[model samples]
Target: MASHQNLNFQGQIPGEFLIARIMQIHASISKLESLRPSKQVNILFSHLVKLCILPSSIDIKALPQEVQQMRQSLIILCARAESLLELEFATYLSKISLPLNDLNRFPYYENYVKLAKLEYGALIENTGVAQLKKVAFVGSGPMPLTSIILASQHMKSTHFDNIDIDETANNLARRIVSSDDEIEKRMKFLTSDIMEVKEKLGEYDCIILAALVGNEEEKAKILGHIRKYMKEGGVLLVRSAKGARAFLYPVVEEHELFDFKVLSIFHPTNDVINSVVLLRKSLIYT
Candidate 1:
């Protein structure tokens, strides 16, 4: 029965259809403002956290004011990094954090690793980013957005931007960051597809790509183009959605342009259905 269903999904979930499905969900959330405050907050917070309203421990208080307030209700802790905020998967947000079992929506697995102290620290250390400036992140939804904000503060050179192809994602990211006093004048937000990065290439020193779509060709195209955006010896951090690894793992292994590596793999101690991958990138062209 499961095999038959997987085959059915494979038959129907083409690239265009998958993109359209994402757009539809975006549209539904856009209209969610009409719902009651309780409902609105519920929906928005769910979307926000799922999209990665996280901060490293060191940067939590330094986060944009709006984002801090947005995260105020959630149960998160401070990590060793001045900018790092830890999400205790065993305590809160575990269900939404690890939604891999669900077939209809996109999920973030890195949140699961944030639950594991041993793995989380290793992931952060493995990033090899002693300093970061002019950071560019694709898939600025949840974990990536949090990372962009945290890394920007850690570098402190000013000028931070989290760019995404989804207008909804960009809008949500802006709303999340708009309130952070620490990020004022230091952060810029953009909504654009990663595929057209050539126009904006050479503007960033580091590029981070987190989250995976089901399409292997699209993923490779994204990775291949992202390197063009970095200066010589710049870094790229890429993480795949749990289900995407079956197809994407081999591609990452074969790709020569990126110094791709897994930073950490997170599995929710409370929820077996959810898992996340933290990976790092280094540009090889330089």
Candidate 2:
């Protein structure tokens, strides 16, 4: 187990102590038999989440080369652990009688709710669209609570297409929302990689790239694909991370999104782990 003594939020330099703490957490997570939801793993991840939100004096980009590399590895490991937890909880809920209504039972359910509210507000303000016609969420996993919450709570009249590379995830997402007729009618789960859906990309009024979708290079590729195929003026919301939270998730750089016009980039200084970048496809592509 990693020691939390150094994280006393004192005058200690963040980069120095953070590296040691990160290595400890990395070693602990690596020893886990699987990233599945277990008592030990959950405890470790909970600590990691708290560590990420701690006040840090040094920026992630200022870390040394080797430390940065290790941090990237830790980020990937954390993403996997998060995905497994979502899958495990989604699978569990799918077997229950009323899964959609009971979604708040999941530990991170409120996080998704907060994220949905943030993204919905950004879409409305940036796009000036009171109700979107069709929206596509790329990399929506087994428990697509974001899409469900957005559809049910924010945009009741909008249609959402939940796209994922894993068919099983898509099936599980379908089952999780099957009980809600309104959301079920508005939500469509499609099993296809976002890269392969170039032909149909233009149909969406908005496309959201989930935070755990890919690594830096993969996200760049997906962004390039969206820039080329998505309709002009369509909004694209890419989930990102800033400050210490970048250690938990891959950060999206503005340079990678040169083709689009950035409308808003919000970095929450709170418990919300994922920052959001709102971009509009340029009407005149260079």
The top-ranked prediction according to TM-score is 2
Instruction: Give the least accurate 10-residue stretch of model 1, judged by summed lDDT.
Output: 75-84
C-alpha lDDT of all candidate models, in order: 0.41, 0.86
- lDDT (tens digit, per residue) of candidate 2 on 71-177: 78888888888889888888998898889878998999998999999999999888788799999999999999899999889989999999999999999999999
Least accurate stretch of 10 residues (summed lDDT) in model 2? 5-14
Candidate 1, 173-277: lDDT as tens digits: 454444445554576667777776675757765565544431445667776666545555554555432321121121233343334444455533332222444
Per-model TM values vs. the true structure: 0.46, 0.94
> Where in model 2 is the C-alpha error above 4 Å?
1-13, 284-286
Clashes of each: 27, 0
Q: Can you give the lDDT of residue 124 in candidate 2?
A: 86
Off by over 4 Å in 1: 1-129, 142-145, 148-158, 241-286
Against the true structure, candidate 2 has what lDDT? 0.86
RMSD of 1: 15.6
